[model samples]
Target: MSEDAGRVPAEPPDLRVGHEERAAAMRALDTHFEAGRLDVTEYGERSGVAGTATHRHELEELFTDLPAPHPEFSPAAGPPAVPEKAPDRHPLGHRHTAMALLPLLAVIGIVLLVVVGGQPAGLAFFPIVFLLAGRFGPRRF
Candidate 1:
């Protein structure tokens, strides 16, 4: 027996394409035509070939001179890499720091209330909390 008898045949690189693949190639050809890369006559010719293409290489040949938006035949490298977020400078952010100071601000306000001899001037300090909250609050889109 020959050594080749034990080995299985490898799949062909130019695999047969399906309707979806042909349609996608046609779409890519449409994009090139719209971009002015292919004139009306060339566009019609390439599109016709794309429609009738039975193998992946035949579709690939249609885009040989074109840029991206080509039909993918090879397997993807891997899942996309997620970007790493930067570390926070302060773990307890500005909002938390502002909240932490609320009790101290209230004490200062009360002292002002007592020393100001019943004048409502101490009420001014309470608005600082609101200003801090507005400045440090979670941002809306």
Candidate 2:
């Protein structure tokens, strides 16, 4: 194994930046300008420098006198966390239960519609139940 295998990689001060970083720095400068921390002329100067900055350190230097709301830089450290696996489920799960219940619910709804014999709006209940079941059913993947 390499000697540095166990160490978190250091973020070099002179790391080259891209357009995204420069834009972020400009946004920070705009915020300071709006908060009255920097006058129009100072804002213009700092924004110019930010627009032309080539390295992470150059951007960091722009915020030396400012407070929070700095541009976020990704750390050169450890690997990203692995996602947890989905839980195991039974062969007959929530989706199966829902599928079995839907027809039964429709039958009950039809019976109510026939017995009550008012508005046929009661038939809408079946579709609503079907939608709810599908939405809240267990994951297939």
Against the true structure, what is each candidate's TM-score? 0.43, 0.48
lDDT of each: 0.76, 0.80
Residue runs of model 1 more than 4 Å from their true location after superposition: 1-11, 74-141
Model 1: how far residue 42 lies from native, Å: 0.5
Q: Which residue pairs in candidate 1 have backbone atoms (N, alpha carbon, C) closer than 3 angstroms, thus clashing?
A: none
Q: After superposition, how far is residue 86 of candidate 1 from its true place, in Å?
A: 57
| Candidate 2 CA-lDDT value | 0.80
Error of 2 at 111 (Å): 91
Instruction: Show model 2 residue runs off by greater than 4 Å.
Output: 1-7, 76-141
Candidate 1 lDDT, 1-141, residue by residue in tens: 999999977546577877888888887888888999999999999988988888777888898888887876544235568989978866978666776676667667767786876866776666675675566555564
Index of the highest-TM-score prediction: 2
Residues 1-141 of candidate 2: C-alpha lDDT, one tens digit per residue: 998999976788998887888988988888988999999988988888889988899999989999998998766546669999877666657667776676567667776786787757776676776665676554477
